[model samples]
Target: MLEPGLYEQTISRELKDELESEKDELVSELRKIDDAEAPKILAEYVAEVAESALARISESGKDSLENQIQLTNKMIGALDSPSDLVGDSHQLLYLVPKVMHQIRGKSERDTLRPETPMSQSSLFTGSRHEPSMGSELKKEIASADRIDMLVSFIKWPGLRIILPELREFSERGGKLRVITTSYIGATDVKAIDELSELPNAEVKVSYDTRGTRLHAKAYVFYRKTGFTTAYVGSSNLSNPAITSGLEWNVKVAQRELPDTMAKIRATFESYWESNDFEPYDKSQHDRFVEAVKRERGDKTPSDLVYFF
Candidate 1:
């Protein structure tokens, strides 16, 4: 059980008294739970009550609740130490709801209402994610210890020119894997061939001989303790595309790279496995295309393309 020191003075006193008063009632409830076949129901009840409390705190404020969040956290910590619901599932069911409530409550109180002027706190917490780009990333990558990348395509001209850089990685001993797909041969052909020839590099290429268009462009670069991934609206693997037109790219910090890499790897494997079959395999991709064309009007991207 958590000691009084774990809580603030006022919260600690109130919690101790509440626990003392509820001791017999809780013991009785625990005995009933032990005999009940449906333990999950009891867990749900705890979770729901905690969630309700959290919502109240969030709608109100810490000051309004008289520091109920602190009291709840300490109580949850105490329940965590030695209890019948010590397992992660049960404990989470009991505590997470309350924790969320406190977080929401604190946030609402500390934050300006929709009626008030937006400031630094509002800006910081507003979006769950945002683009990170600029000289800061360039400087960090420049000094990083290692760099690894996977890309649908590279926009630099004469990507064969980068073969030396690819060779240098092999010469010095490093790892890189890349896969490319595109609507035309001229766009990704040279880069695919160049990287494939490197000593230790892995490269995959997808060609839609049936005039199927390939359009997604994504890149991953991992360096030292950090990295960056860019998902772009345009495929600029060729010199003409990058030098001649306006292209947009959203760069995200690679702290979450592992998950993204897994997704990319899975997609590559799926494409590779199906590449040998006839283009008319009627796979999930085909179903999705049909659904899109049917559900959306003729203006949707899928409606304009013919797969079969």
Candidate 2:
């Protein structure tokens, strides 16, 4: 009287439930192990599972002789170094599966995967193999929903290169926030003026030239896709720094280094909320210029006095 395929469906559900119970039991057992012993135990378990799988394959007699020989040779090569075997086994059993899951979908793969095959993190040293920081920054800006930049100073030459990208980003309704300082009169008023004029931009300047020593430089690109990126290092918004200088910047991916990215976002928010950097206003342009001139030891007309 039961409907066709209903019996098969019930069996499938039962099997799934049984497998889930077994998986939960295995996880519970794994959680009881001490951190120091976990690696060795996991490695041993992998070796045992691999040995059993190989034994089953050998007994099955289904694979071609050449294929079997090739697989055996690979296994022998993998076992040559016991220490390396343990490490490789861990990667194959744990890391590989997790990475595979993360990049299974096309969109997820493109967003979460590192641009370079070397690693999930990147070091931009202005080398031939590495992509230029300028290009990377533009790419981030183009795709970002919001951009945050904290630099010691901004130079017109560097800002000019990426200005078009920033303009397009703003036009597309992307929010931009910048934090810079008049620490050494290195920042150009022109750059600040142009940035503030952007449709969706906010600029903050630290006029406490003598006391405020904010020298950190970072650019954070926040994406709604959950794959945010942040560049942190010695590179300021300068032509040489982004284009050809030997500046060292570490590009961190939120998907790969969640803790580090979280810290970065938190720190930037703290700095943004702090009163040390005041919101830049067009009316205060003269004041900002004077501050920069004073820091640079350039005497303005106001500093000069006419004798009677």
Output the number of the TM-score-best candidate.
Answer: 2
Worst 10 residues of 2 by lDDT: 85-94
- Model 1, 210-250: lDDT tens digits are 45444565444444433334333343444433233344544
Predicted candidate 2: what Cα RMSD to the true structure? 17.2
Q: For every model shown, what is its TM-score relative to the native structure?
A: 0.37, 0.62
Error of 2 at 203 (Å): 0.5
Tens-place lDDT per residue, model 2, 97-134, is 67777757766434433354222568888897778888
- Which whole-number lDDT from 0 to 100 does residue 130 have in model 2? 79
Off by over 4 Å in 2: 1-119, 298-308
Candidate lDDT (C-alpha), each:
0.42, 0.76
Model 2 score (lDDT): 0.76
